[model samples]
Target: MKNLYFLALLIGFNLSAQELPNLNLLNLEGKSVSLKNDFMEKDKIYVFSFWATWCGPCINELEEMNELQEEWKKEINIEIIAVSIDDSRTQKRVKPLVKGKEWNYNVLLDTNQDFKRAMSIVNPPYTIVVKNGKIVHIQNGYVPGNEKDLYEKIKTL
Candidate 1:
């Protein structure tokens, strides 16, 4: 019975993890944006990158993506949304960091972490690739050149 229960739970988690949590997050401009509704462009790929201001690897991932975004877009119908997981105290740093770096990403602020909790994301630099309102790929952590792998995956979708 215990083994069966565990299997059931595992299956349930797996299923939920594949779908984007229907939640609204605030963008850097302080506008509420629905992850599912607002971003649901038919046949277009959406890359949601979760990052925090303090995380070094997260910064690296976003910077790399920002640099490659234009070139990637020419080849794929893709959009990159950087979701900042910074809480109230650190939230102040988000805009300046993005502006200073001059990143072209659509930056969203997950101040209360509602979106993060709903998506079961545990760390920064966690990326999700979605299409037609469904999550098609996930990269849990970032290493140098991981963006290249992510770009390849997006091309396949």
Candidate 2:
């Protein structure tokens, strides 16, 4: 039932042309960055994967994407930004966990969930693909092979 509910949510949240929120979020190193200004490359696709330090599938999705990013970049102009939604309590674990995993993604700290609220994201492992400041695609959950589908979607943009 939980899976079904998540699926329903996922289907309902497939945003076609929503513009990204002009919100400033802190990166892991505590630098305030603007979502719109900092990531506005001419035609580059930015994959923002929202996750938390405690979510297993969230970690899995990022790990798989990390492994596949090199090959994907060879064929497309893309950047993956792993946005951590770990609030103040668990937020401290985020850095150590990221370091331990050795992920190469640009990590953004969404400590107050401003970005998540702006995006209306309900869960972790939620991914949004943005191009030219507009959200082109969104995936609400992670499965072992979902990275392939994400790659294919990015290719079409």
Candidate 3:
């Protein structure tokens, strides 16, 4: 009985230890914000989606995420922040393109790629699920129906 109780406690600690790490990044307004400070306080889940204007897959994911934003928010307090990894030369196109698409979620520009380096993301449409400021899951590349799995993950959290 004593060994069983100790084993249960160890398992519980191990499960909690799998929580995500806290990393800071800039918002669309160019303001630095700690990921934990922004997403963890209310115990809500947030999605940090890295993207670029020229990437077709990234664009598709953003569009789908936009369409499902309202529904997802209703079910869970999820914030899908689309971070544009456009370089200085292409950065000028971001605003116009985003404005044209009429995407409603929070958008940020990663002109210097600092955020990308911090996250160690090498591709566009890289999505990370953050809960209470910790990264719980990461997915690289995007597919047409990937948002469904994302929503399921968020719902369970």
Off by over 4 Å in 1: 1-17
Clashing pairs in 1: none
Rank order (by TM-score, best first): 2, 1, 3
Q: Which candidate model has the greater TM-score, 2 or 3?
A: 2
For candidate 1, lDDT tens digit of each residue in 25-107? Answer: 88888889988788999999999999999999999999999999999989998999999999999999999999999999899
Report the poorest 10 consecutive residues by lDDT, candidate 2: 8-17
Candidate 1 lowest-lDDT run of ten:
11-20
lDDT of 2 by residue, 50-135 (tens): 99999999999999999999999999999999999999999999999999999998999999999999999898889999999988
Q: Rank candidates, lDDT, best first.
A: 2, 1, 3
Kindly report which residue stretches of model 3 are placed more than 4 angstroms away from their true locations once superposed.
1-34
Query: Of 1 and 2, which scores higher on lDDT?
Result: 2
lDDT of each: 0.90, 0.93, 0.80
Model 2 earns a TM-score of 0.90
- Candidate 3 is scored at a TM of 0.80
